[model samples]
Target: MMGGRGEGVGCVGGVGGRRVGVRGLGGVFEDKCKEGENEPYRGALAPALALALAPALANTHHHNIIKLSLQGNVGHLVQQHAICHGNLDYKLEDGQGPVLMTTVAMPVFSTKNETRNRGILLGVVGTDVPVSELLKTIPKYKLGIHGYAFAITNNGYILTHPDLRPLYGDGKKRRKPNYSSVDLSEVEWEDKDDTLRNAMVNRKTGTFSMEVKKSVDKGKRVLVLHNDYYYTDIKGTPFSLGVALSRGHGKFFFRGNVTVEEGLHDLEHPDVALADEWTYCNTDEHPEHRYLSQIEAIKLYLSGHEPHLQCDKELIQEVLFDAVVTAPLEAYWTSLVLNKSENSDKGVEIAYLGTRTGLSRINLFVVPDELTNQDFLTAEDKEGVFNADHFPLWYKRAAEQVPGTFVYSLPFNTGSENKSVVLASTAIQLLDERKSPIAAAVGIQMKLEFFQKKFWTASRQCAALDGKCSISCDDENINCYLIDNNGFVLVAEDYTLTGKFFGEAEGAVMSKLLQMGSFKRVTLYDYQALCWVFSESSDSGHTLLDPYFAFFSAVKWILTELVIFLVEFNLYSWWYSDLTAKGYNKGKRRKRMRKEDG
Candidate 1:
């Protein structure tokens, strides 16, 4: 995870304080042409032959002349022809290292001019900046920290050419084996990041960080920031751009849009109310209590479905109904239920309900026979339901539009034959002090199948109150249908469609793109969404959007550029003309024009 730092904005300071200016470099390269006048040059074949052989290197300036000279089969003597004698060495740090510098003397053996005498061009004509000076490209990001920015070649070579002794090595005994020209690909003993390597090959643009175990600071993990940039001019070449920032201070810079995490900690409104409710519900003081005998009394009054246990289901309903009318279940977060598990005497079953603050897990019921002291679910069992198959089932309930009940069977075995049991729930509205609804949920649990049917009735009542059309069935395979804006079936399934309208997704996805920085608002269309897993699909894909945002963005960009052009033109006119003569220039020009006309 990237560490949090406040929002900031900075730019790459220009490549200023250059060792050799443009004019100086140009003068050195053109000195030979300046000394002599144009002659009838007849040694064109010699120059042509040289070009044919070293076409890639010919007439191009590079970092090392020795490497370049060796590449072309032309044998030439190289020596340090000191031009910027004092200026070159002055830039070196500490000034104790060898003047690791050199120049060249090319003998002009021509067939036309001065054939007998060996006239030599002494100056190689190039700019040489110290390695220490090259390190300036990396800038410090914040105060009270040592943050250095550097650049590497696409192949992970240190192209900026930092002194290997201090940066990569400890400088005492263990010196890095010529890291100045080495690529990470050649290092077998160290961990070569495949991520950084792939970024160069694919020419990606993004920011990433990794720990550098090879650092001289042993055991102290050093975080290195790798910010990839794409260079259009060097596209498809053997080089890619990578800016490596040394993060000694706990700050990492992301290149593009502000992420949710980046905006989270520094946001003025942190949404603490919902967070506090979640945190409180996660921990509390409680002892396991059973009210089965009290709840069973009311069940005998309601019509009996099974041959026995009729009284038990009725009592559970009255207990839930009276609790809402009299007792306040401030239930801002998830409800919790304590139970005995297969391994432990007491364990919690959590049902998570997500609100504005955060998604919370609460299990509100503990049934006697359903799961009495089997040892709570093991860690492996909990992880099984965290995947795409089971998680979406949980999402439908936690982020419901209306009061709904879903009969989902837990993986645990319940009956004497060890059959899996399911829970049917009746959702009740939880209200705030203003009597406004905060959440819709009911804390009722039962094993009786007859009482379970009441959950569907309660669902219909809650749905009507919440303005949702719904249908229920005993056969689990049957599903509900909704209508789209076009009156077409929103989702096509085997279940019968009796709803007012139908639509499944927002609409078919549109291929049209939006202009840069266009505002796209989220919209919701009401439909009877089926509450079963078979009805829902993961990664449903995108929805069709109108081209309005893209159209507007183009107009904004054009207008902005036109305005900028006009403003720049006016500014240039003001700066170019003589300020003192501006007002009187028209009058003076008119008099001069009249005289000329006369």
Candidate 2:
């Protein structure tokens, strides 16, 4: 029996009715009895028993008695025995020897919708070309069907070429056959109160609905529902306005034939004005058929003073290029007036040019001359300066180059630098090269190291405090995992956290977890965490446990050390440490002197 103090007894053979009990062997064991008794045994059963069980006991106790001298010598034999028969638990533990726990409640798991809600915007650029022409160009450019494009406008009206026009023809060719209009009795319904059932019951018979549906289907893109009256209803009657609306229901509603002079009057009281007299009307109902005149469309196109030409390949390119050069100013001005009217003190001015996949934005920042020259590039092209202490004036100058443009400004405190520009430019060289605006914007705000550290630390803290640390990989293409305070993973087997966008996805996940109100702090594991976790696993070949646990523990230790180093160096603070400390010390001395004088 294996017990405390390693003491046990085994039976020895008796000689001729007399029993002999042996104590310590010291390399000698003998059974002695009377001379007349049977021949005394040469070897004692106790010694044999000890010899047989010693090897097994040594193998079992080798792990616990690693520091023992004899045990060290039996390392190879013990290891061999363990490999052949022993099962071990090799889970890693913290320095304090506590079992590492992970919580699924960490702030890093979220749905796509929730991620978008946290200031993620998806933008698409559109063109006026017919679906057929667009489709032809799509493959040539190697562009996604759901992407950006320069609008083709002739005299401010979207140009439609003959090739493109073929895509938009008579209602019969454009619309799908409405089998939805079949009798309700012939159709199957799983639920009586289903919205689809209701839609079938109220089947719309208007040609406009068919035309709109056909356009949408041809576009082959998901249409986000906009509640704006211009895009939805005309006097409460549904009418499709083919334009993308901004987040706040704002859109560019072009009136084809009406002049600016006539537009102002129509906008004031649109109900009384004839449709031909107005450029665009904000109404909840579709205009009457007789009111849709060709002249109105023509005037609206001409109002912007844009050149008109018969739609052709050359003409299309010319119009598109012109729109690209001029659209930025138009977009900027529209944003400004809307923001002012809304009484928003903090507004962002944006000038957008190009299409969805090749878009660029010019952000204007207004700053004083002194700070501006140091921080941002000047339009004057000052040499030898690589950095700016404040936003330069060049962005405002860029804004001024176009008409009706304005800058977005927020209220500022006295003596503070008022504005900063963030110019987000995407490589328009090709469709595939379009950078994600969301990613670019976030990239500017914080360093990748800072983000990674914050995420990993937060995750570890959450796991330590909570029993379960929940982690999910949004980008399945990449391998990502959350490490516990001891660096073990809570994820299932066959999953790994690796790849380029893993950190960003982890950040997004963390944001969602925060919203769900599960865990307060969440951190994303980075390469540093990976290194720590992996190195420890490689070192410990004796312990038998999940390799993930060893890694998790190492990551936790690494993060903990990083946090300590940052705190010790005062690196977490934004201020220049040496200068701030010096200034603070001076102030303290002055205060002490004044107190002594008093």
Candidate 3:
């Protein structure tokens, strides 16, 4: 949460002394932007790339010049020059003409001394022979290459590179190697124990034991293979097989045991009970084991499917009847009027009920004629104030329409000094409602000047008898009596009153006056009541009556009393009945208590 220490009518300082202006009522949803404002431009990729890459290669020589500068260099110097040129000539043609090219060929080389003579002699001796004869010379000479090719041909096809085959042979001449005799059986065989007794034991078990063991091993191997295969299939790659196998064993042992035990337990005790006997069966091995006797009672009530208990039917019916009888009469009138006047022109239609203390009491202000069809309102027309001087007339009209509720407009203060006095007086009046007459008088005076200028400030200050006082904006310069909720006056000024009223008061009486300064928004009717009760009281001089009287008076004056009345009389019955219908009597009781406390 954020905290602050000053009170004013306009902007206030927030965290880090940032100013946040007070937003007026009804400004929460207003838009701040004007229509047709152009959005700012965002940069494109071409401009961004040009900006990033243009500077680095701004001044460099061509590759041809760099190459020519180091054409005949040697050692690291030549290598460095070649690298610095950084050029490749892949095109067949030069700058002006086709480039020359050359080719060099060498006879096939072999590492063995015996095979070296064959390659050289065969190629030299057959230089004059036709290409076909030259190719056939190696096989006719019973060359080792020819023998190798024959061996591969007689056995199976030789799986060597295609380019090396001319020195070997075509498929018809050479025998192929028998890769089937490569001894894969050694890789496949299983070892046996060396002890004779172990061998005899193995024989007695027969090929049956070996076969069973192999089958069991094969089964385990198949399981592992499937685990690996499916594991990689899901994950899209292979992981550690050992870790997977270990995890699989753990799951099997623990989960399988649990499953078996649960199955057996379920079979042995098929109709076990639950802990909450009211909601479920209670058949567990404990002292409370029994058939639920309340089941029939619950079913009987639930059968109707009405959200009320059998015992609460009367209360529910009574509530429905009360709602029908006590529904507000104004709501019905408003609805009927709205329906009939759907097409009526809108205008200020002030309704008044009666006159009291020379004031025409208002009931409602009807929609105005010109504003009904419009969507926008200027600052002067914002609060539907058509004429401030005739506000009492509007109140009188509204009063005529609604009988019980009082309606009136707050007086508009003007003329600098007088305005401050009026506002200070209003603030003092509000504080005075809490039964502190002297504080109210002082509070009004403290803020007289500022209020005159249409600026309001509230502050805490110390009072006599160790109490606190608050100086609110008001007309007079009174400062001694006003106090806030914390019993401190906000104005820092000398509080010695020299008036005849101050001289008549005793110390305790003055303390009571100081205590009264902490009130907020006291009404005339309540002040009259407090005066009737405390004006002649002695001893503590009405100080004891201040806090309690203020609290009760606030409850009566504010709409909060009506809200509490509605909750207690209407909402409580409805909620309790609802809970009772759902077979939750205890819940209903608790809900009633909670509603009362709240």
Candidate 4:
């Protein structure tokens, strides 16, 4: 029943509601705050407005947009409702007339993965605000104010204009008639009527002149003017706003009421040949935020799609911080290769690690600049950047010393500024049947100071040589090799075998000098290295070996040889029969039995 309500918009009415405060031109400087998760207040506010205006209302929303993604359709709906609701309460008749309201609706994809063919409707009803306030409400993009602004609908209806009335009002009997949502592109502005089309094409910020409908003089036909406008496509929601200010006053003045059909209509020079320089602008002089494109990127990213547009480095950083640190772990991360500048050579490498709880983690990956390549690094260049002495052993070491994290340390090297650094954090695994790692960790290039300060590193203290003993391992003798549980060598005497099981190491025989203590042999368990206890230690190359394991292996070898000997000698059946023969357990010898004997 909200259809064609603009037709009866002539009468004036007063409705007692909260007086809305216009932020004015200054509001254009304020940054937009992040909206609440997925929910648009206007979806509910519109109905409340309808109840106050038309008490017999059945619905506040003609269609629901909750099915749309939390980023796009939902966000735009919230923005429109906010802009309308915060303006004023408008009515048609004084004190007791039907309340005037502006309804906004757009089709948005249900979720990130769904296509546009399945877009859901997001709609909101708001009290109609005066045109004056609407014209002054420009978005703040960290750029200065635009020269002027205008509002339009999806079908190209002129919602609000600054210095003009209805494009073609019936008469002065109506100051402004409610066209509800009229197609202003059908009318003329500047020299022609192509403003809306051009605006849509310049989805971001561009300079274009449209045929001005409803000029201030109401009689100017060819009054063409140039302006710079910022376009905002309300993210996820289906709406756009064009805000701009005039670039120049004019080259000449024409009669305010004269319509220029073809030839010049200026009274001073009716047949004057005009040049395009007076109103030509190829590009924006001070390009800034293009709202429409930004919203598209937002919607695309939220709906599980990669945004095609080049992400702003600052914006990209902010988004990553929010997703990896601030947002709940349920909001998984997406990767981005951010370019610091369009002309810059190197790009930032980014990755994400998700978790069950949204607890923020610090750097989990630290690639020492000197050690991140095919070339070898000296001890000083490598430092604790890796665990081992050789480059390959570093790879064998885990990125983190512990199961869930890395040893975080901040290097004092001033030269780290030119180096590429990445911070990685643990992430939760995905629930797919593959049971593969859904997410391992989140990482970002070490550019932003915010990333650099949260850096993590691990360090260790050097132990004295008193408890250490020399042992020959794998023909490469080592003073002391780190060993693990079950008498397996870890940091083998031979550096090449660090990652392989210590039991597989060659020449790992115990040394006689190390046979002094009950637990002189050292090993590691749960990642901690320690000296293990032995029954006794002796000189002459005596090693502390677990006797039970030796016994178990010997038994296994004997059983294997016995089976082979019986099979090779063709006595397998005789051996089996003898072993299972009834007389064996009964303590009595049995005569050969025939198949017929039951």
Best by lDDT: 4
Candidate rank order under lDDT: 4, 1, 2, 3
Give the poorly placed runs of model 3, Cα more than 4 Å off: 1-3, 6-304, 307-322, 326-405, 408-598
What are the RMSDs of all candidates, in order? 32.6, 41.6, 52.6, 33.1
lDDT of 3: 0.22
Predicted structure with the largest TM-score when compared to the true one: 4
* Candidate 4 wrongly placed segments (more than 4 Å): 1-90, 93-100, 105-136, 139-146, 167-178, 186-188, 191-198, 201-204, 209-230, 249-598
TM-score of 4: 0.22
* Model 1: residues with Cα > 4 Å off, grouped in runs: 1-95, 98-123, 142-148, 153-156, 161-177, 185-195, 198-240, 245-598
TM-score to true structure, per model: 0.20, 0.17, 0.12, 0.22
**Which residues of candidate 2, in runs, are more than 4 Å off?**
1-202, 205-598
- lDDT digits (tens) for residues 390-432 of candidate 1: 1122232322223444423232212232222232233333432
Candidate 4, 1-598: lDDT as tens digits: 0122211110000012211122221231112222322221232221222112221111222222232224354543333323222221234566423332343333332333454344454444333333332221221111111123444433344444333233233322232333343344433233244655455422232334432212211121112234533343332222334544333321111111212221111111211111111111111112432333333343334344443433333332232333333333222221112223431333333332222111122221223352232122223332212111111111112211234443211121213243323333332223332222222234333332333232211011111334332332323333444442222332323334443333345433433223533123321111111122469656644333767777888999999999999787787566676564333633233333433365
TM-score of 2: 0.17
Listed per model in order, the count of residue pairs whose N, CA or C atoms clash below 3 Å is 28, 54, 61, 45
**Residue lDDT tens for model 3, 1-598:** 0111111110000112211121122221111111121122233221222222111111111122223333422222221211111110112334422211111111222335675445332210001111121121111111110011100111111111111112112223322132211111111112233221222111111110111011011011110011100000001000000001111111111001223233223222212111121121122223333332323323333346523333222222222222232223235435644764642432222222211111111212244442221311122222221111111222212222223322222122222222211111121111212221110011011122332123223232234535755543342664334322212222223222211122132446545645675222211110001111236545764754699887877877777778879879897788777553345579889999999999
Candidates in order have lDDT scores of 0.29, 0.26, 0.22, 0.30
lDDT of 2 at 311: 17
